[model samples]
Target: MPVSKRWTVEVLIGEDHGNTSAVARLDTNDGTHLVGAGQARLNPADDDIPAIGDELAAARALSDLGHRLLLTAAADVAAVAEQPVHLTW
Candidate 1:
């Protein structure tokens, strides 16, 4: 059987006092409810550059979100195996 589902992700970006910040929120539910929040910031030495800031912020936010998701997965696996998970890759 083939199964599929949809997850929603929202990324918000903003700049304040020479600091560019971004936050990514992901919502997933598969008989289990889980929400993840990822945040990132960039302090540019030069003037305001929207393109560069966006790229940096978005990349960082995604990286953070990925880390959180991996952590959750590891915890789940450890719970089922009754042992801690140590991923090497």
Candidate 2:
């Protein structure tokens, strides 16, 4: 069967006291949800750049989400194959 589905990810970022954090939420459309988080800390000696921090945090969060998705897929494959499975990027 040929099928197509749309998945969306929402990223939220916050900064407090020079610490920036981001969260990425994934909606799989199958009632399964996944969340990934990342953080960035500004150095006192360095210039404060909110955009840079947000970029780093968001990138890390998305990376984390991708890894988690891989793990979930691996587990599902293992369940159907009746064996332990390891997925590689």
Candidate 2, position 9, lDDT: 97
What does the lDDT read for residue 38 in candidate 1? 36
TM-score of 2: 0.93
The TM-score that candidate 1 achieves is 0.75
Task: After the best TM-score superposition of candidate 2, give how far the Cα of residue 76 lies from its true spot, in angstroms.
Answer: 0.3
* Estimated TM-score for each candidate: 0.75, 0.93
Best by TM-score: 2
Question: How accurate locally, in lDDT, is each candidate?
Answer: 0.69, 0.93
Off by over 4 Å in 2: 1-3
List runs of model 1 lying over 4 Å from the truth: 1-3, 31-45
